[model samples]
Target chain A: MYTDLVAALDIGGTKIAGALVDGHGRILVRAQRPTPARENGDTVMRAVEEVLAELTASPLWGRASGVGIGSAGPVDASAGTVSPVNVPGWRDFPLVARVRAAAGNLPVELIGDGVAITAAEHWQGAARGHDNALCMVVSTGVGGGLVLGGRLHPGPTGNAGHIGHISVDLDGDLCPCGSHGCVERIASGPNIARRALENGWRPGADGDTSAAAVAAAARAGDPVAVASFERAAQALAAGIAATATLVEIDIAVIGGGVGKAGDVLFEPLRKALSTYATLSFVRHLTVAPAQMGTDAGLVGAAAAALAKRTDAAAAGV
Target chain B: MYTDLVAALDIGGTKIAGALVDGHGRILVRAQRPTPARENGDTVMRAVEEVLAELTASPLWGRASGVGIGSAGPVDASAGTVSPVNVPGWRDFPLVARVRAAAGNLPVELIGDGVAITAAEHWQGAARGHDNALCMVVSTGVGGGLVLGGRLHPGPTGNAGHIGHISVDLDGDLCPCGSHGCVERIASGPNIARRALENGWRPGADGDTSAAAVAAAARAGDPVAVASFERAAQALAAGIAATATLVEIDIAVIGGGVGKAGDVLFEPLRKALSTYATLSFVRHLTVAPAQMGTDAGLVGAAAAALAKRTDAAAAGV
Candidate 1:
């Protein structure tokens, strides 16, 4: 089994990524193409096919036992379809069927990209060896997944651990998802920058008004910028504490652009967590920065494929 | 196995209730004793032993296979200890060992009272046959437990679903549990009655200031009383939505004293759920009243014992 491999795809609005990954999570071959996100569904799918063609052309392709796709969601793993918010051209797109066809009729597993990231972290990154954990990405959007009872809990629809959309402030600002005070509304990278600028923080000479710029200003002791990050941390802490209280997670791994704000974000988060996660079972919960890098999607896709393979074999499939 | 019974104990601050439950969840023998909650640890243990002795005196006790205890938590199932907040004298009490000895050394299983209710609900109540659900008791406190992937998720500590203490309002009133705006702080029966009284809703000539009194006043179109129940319903809805968002539970079964307030609570809760459970996967979540009655704890304890017995047999123990 160590000699065998799985073909993996990380499909997002910006790129179609393909790889042949070994059993130990090593990428033996890789291919990528920019997604034609604004075009029709068929056009975007062609880009995915081309990336798959490159992976299939590799000599290691023959050793691939299955294919796994981690896609921008809401993905219906049960229906083998995806309806990513950023990709308007592909609502209810039959991704698993198309990927299976492109990969020579091999078995295919589909999961939301956040769940994929969690799979990576649980297998080889910050959440490794922890039975109950949550791994999150706090970039343009906040997304996450859970590992429960020592296994990835993708739920019936493969979208269980969606912490960002969960309301922490029931009466706060209305979110685009039609919810009030969602964690993403307060803690995402764009929201952090927006809140900072709203409260009178100005960008540097470069005019770079991103969360990274806000992080730099916060480190420099800018009061308004510091306050913005503190608010985001507060919302994140509330959400994380809620998650721990609900499911008894021992650790929460945070990644993406805003998570890299270091102590500027973590300090206030730790303080706020103490205020919210007061339960006996949840008081010991810890927050850590995610260790998986940009390739987490591909690696996690491979892990999903491997798990599916094992499950099928156990069922005599 | 059908002829075998499990001895079940429902330990709380007010009472020590025991029963001999068969495989079909029918109680054949019963025993009860008032809890010596303020007495020393030995007195409380003695009360439990007396209850067990009563059950042992029944002729049916000869066919008992195991014993299960569902105690007010936080229960440490791994360590076989209980530290129920309402029962101070029994902090870290070795209930499992004591019960095992009292029950002729039969194998024992321990779970939190909330988890016990969830097992009963999943097995024979409103949440029956659901693969994933949350069962809650909203009486003096808002305790709850989860069923995930068709199995009771008691977590490692036997206290996975302590929903009462989860903060839904991050900056709201400080809770007695050292948290801010816990669900119990806002939605528990006492809190509901208190909020109504705080807002000038006077009790009747009967001087009954319970949540039930508020429910009656609200039913008679008292605006203040209606508003208080609405506020409690709002907090409960937020907590339930957060649970559904994090774990993908399709149904939330609510029981206990406050739950019996009927349309006064349920109407507002259903409306508020739409404001918080906004995600596609969570939008369809339903709230239903718990079907199991006062005996839920004993039956649920029996379910835990039966499950443990089956697991041990499967392991060839």
Candidate 2:
């Protein structure tokens, strides 16, 4: 069934991404442009329009029925607006209207970047076939979304999966949200590098070693690297396992940049899960890595569009 | 809306309960009998039957069209069987079929007792109007149910909400589930009393002061009692906060025997929540006492019958 394609956009701090996605979670035509960070919301929308125009061609665009944009944090999906904490210019901006204006307003859907990834995972990735699970992006700022009892929670303010803000340690570190000991305070990419630098494990700006490098070094038997990954994993896993005790999902899907630590992260993460979530049933909680890689946001946006179709069909009002 | 009344039964180790409930979440009649633990499953069923028979004299019984049961842990809600860890003679016993047979072919529905309470809370109590929440029983066991995105997760075996088993401290305590540091082992009623007695709080049967007594004494300003409650709250709040971070629910319904500590529990619970859940959003999670109280099981069971009716109507196939 040709349910019409959706132009999925991922608006990041550094990049503007747009993709034409069909109902089956496939990315057809894609466009990428640099994001103008310092510019106001209007300028940002202009850049988004340029990227969309390049993909639409006004011909292929006819085949697409709507637009879906996954933006950064503190979003209000219900209002179709965003108050991104990272992009200072985007305070209560009407991003969905702008994207709709750029794409000729077939229908516009917006979600937290985290929620988009969660939808992507549920639709056709590591979290497939699971109704209750957490889709977590452990990247620049840890965030997540939940598919609980087989439904997505857009939350009252669309901030349901803000995992990075959850504080595991009381006196550990401070986060951008003015919280102390948040997982993001100590486990985000920059935090990992800083921790490494503080411990004399990071080689420096010239080294430019990522969390992935720490994972590699940990694998190579580097004690400090091992310790860094373990510390971050400890915080992340504690939070995850604690959640398992309450929400009781069968699995957790990890994605985003920091998730690339792979086994270095998963192994220790599992160990931590076992340690923190010692419940009989919860001990069996499985941790899986996302399979969709970088295209998750786009695929997830398409899934959002598909969900709208399903909801509308279900209502039949 | 006179869909038919449901005879809902709850069989705990300490109590046997029966209630007649209509589709609108109203309990028309209620009765209780002490559980004869030394007797086998057959004897227990006879006791349950006796209680049900007592309730049948009520006017609502004539309208009762079905039965719903919520049994102790390790139950198979789908199969309507239970082998409660504390109750003997229940090894794979088909509680639903037996209860149905006793009820004379009444449509029988089965759910984890915890899930049953969760259903009740979601329908009429703390979790009402919330799409995602948890129903937790901090009584004889640390049992719970997940109402994620507004659906109850019975798991494959219907034993999904076993929150007490979630390990809060790896080196904390030994649980019957063979895992270390389960919240149950650390914070459940028995453990609370056990630890308090072990710590030389009150002179009595060690583990006998009861979680209730601890709450009372704590409320009355006993240092030992205060400490015990704090420890339990600390563990429980951490678990609750972690769960909020994962599911991002608006409320959690806490019920069962031990939840009566009231502010004694809620105060320390909040303190621990704010301490362990550093994330601003999760730290804002709400906790409420279960509204249905002891009848929550019956209420939830009747809700299940109501759900069955709604489903049958919707299908019309």
Candidate 3:
């Protein structure tokens, strides 16, 4: 099984990425296309088709045994459909069927992008050796997935580890997801920037008001910037602690733009964790930066495909 | 294995209960003793031994094939130890080893009391037939267990579903467990009574200030009493919602004293669930009163023993 290759797609609101990946997790062929996200579902499917066409043009395409998709979600893995919050036009899109058809009717595996990243981390990155882990993307919108008891826990809907939307503060700020005090509302990249600006932190002459700007200011000893990151860290700590308590995860891997803030985020995050992760079994949990880079989604999709194929073969399918 | 009986024990800070349970989960024989919790660990073990001695003396004892124990936790099944918070006399006590020795070297299984209840719920109670569920006991202190993918998720240390201590309000009041705004601190029976009293709700001439008294007051239209239950309901809803969001549980079964508050708790809890459980997959989650009664711990311990023996036999161990 490890000698075979899989065709993988990482579909997001911004782009469609496809790769032919060997079982070793190395991409042997790659292609990309801008997503027509605002267009109708068919148009968005066309862009994905174009990416698949490019991948199929490669000589390595013939060697691929299955197709795997990691898509921005509300994915219904049971129904083989997706409705990404960021891709309104693709609501309830029949993604698995489309990908399977485009990939020469090969067996297809579909999972939410968060779960995909978790698969990648568990297979070859930060969570590689851990039997239970949480891998998160603390970006414009916080998202995450779980690896429980050494398997990808995508759940029935491929959306089990949607940590970003879980309320850490029952009485805190309202989130766009219609919940109040969600982890993403406090800890995402935009939230970090918003809190900093709300607290009277100003950007430099560059006029960049992103979380990165706040990170730079915090590094230069700006009190307001530091406080904002600490607040975000606090919310993240509580959410992570709650997750660990519920599921017994041993490690939390943080990625995305905000996570890359380095000490500005990690230092405060480590400090706040001690306050919330108080249980005897959970007290030993550690947080680390995610080692998977931008290609994580594609690699993770490939991993899921390989896993499915292996399971199918074992079942004598 | 359904033709064989098993020995089951439920050990708490207050009592040691033992039973010779048949394969059908019926308690054919029972024994119990008050726990000398304030005494040394050896003294506490004596009470357990006495209970076991009574069980061993039963006419049906020879039919028991295995033993299972559910103890007040922080229990480490991997290390065969327990250090229950309320039982200060036994920290890291070798409970499994002690039980194994006392049970004539028969195969033994151990799990946290919460997990035991969950096993009961999953096996034959409200969560029956559900592939994923959270079963909770909302009594003097909130405790819970999980059944994921059709099996009891006791986790590596037999303490997976210790939901009572997970903080829902990260910045709220400090919990005795060293965290803040834990579900237990807000929604447990004692907390309900304490909060009702703190908010100027008084007891009647009989001087009963228990949560059951508060429940009676709420039923009789006492606004302060109603509000106290509402607050507890809100915290419970948040915690349940968080659990559903993280693990994709389809239902949450509530048992124990506060759960017996009936509509006074359930009505508000059902209403509050919608406010926090707004995610796509989790929005459909339901809450119900647990069907298993006072003997859930014993029945669940028996279930665990049966399951262990079955698995061991399958593995040819």
* Top candidate, metric lDDT: 3
Question: Is candidate 2 or 3 superior in lDDT?
Answer: 3
Q: Report DockQ per prediction, comma-separated.
A: 0.78, 0.31, 0.80
- Could you give the candidate ranking by TM-score, starting with the highest? 3, 1, 2
The docking quality of candidate 3, as DockQ, is 0.80
Pairs with steric clashes in candidate 2: A165-B279, A167-B278, A167-B279, A278-B167, A279-B165
lDDT of each: 0.91, 0.76, 0.92
What is the clash tally of candidate 1? 0
lDDT of 3 by residue, B1-317 (tens): 44489999999988889999988888899999998999999999989999999998988888888999999999998899999888999999998889889989888899999999999988889999899999999999999999988888888888988889888899999998888988999999999999999999999999999999999999999999999999999999999999988889999999999999999999999999999999888999999999999899999999999999888887899
DockQ of 1: 0.78
- Model 3, span A1-317: residue lDDT tens: 45599999999989999999999999999999999889999999999999999999998888889998999988989899999988899878899898888889999999999999999989989998899999999989999999988888888888889999888888989888888899999999999999899999999999999999999999999999999999999999999999998889999999999989999999999999999999899999999999999999999999999999998898899
lDDT of 2 by residue, A1-317 (tens): 22677788888888889889887888889888898878888887788888898877845777887777778766777677887766788888988888877777678888788888898898889888897788889877788887766766656556666666665654455566654567777778777767876797856456757777777778888888888888788777766765555555678898877788887788888887766765444667888988887888888878877677667777893
Query: Where in model 1 is the C-alpha error above 4 Å?
Result: A1-3, B1-3
| Candidate whose DockQ is highest | 3
Q: By the TM-score metric, which is better: model 1 or model 2?
A: 1
Q: Write the per-residue lDDT of candidate 2 for residues B1-317, one digit (tens) a residue.
A: 32667888887888988898877877778889888877888898889888878877786677887777777767766567888776787788888887877777878777778888888888888888887787798987788887765667666566766777765554455677766566778778888888777887784455457778777777888888888888888778756765666556667778877788898888888777766665434555788888887678778777766666666677992
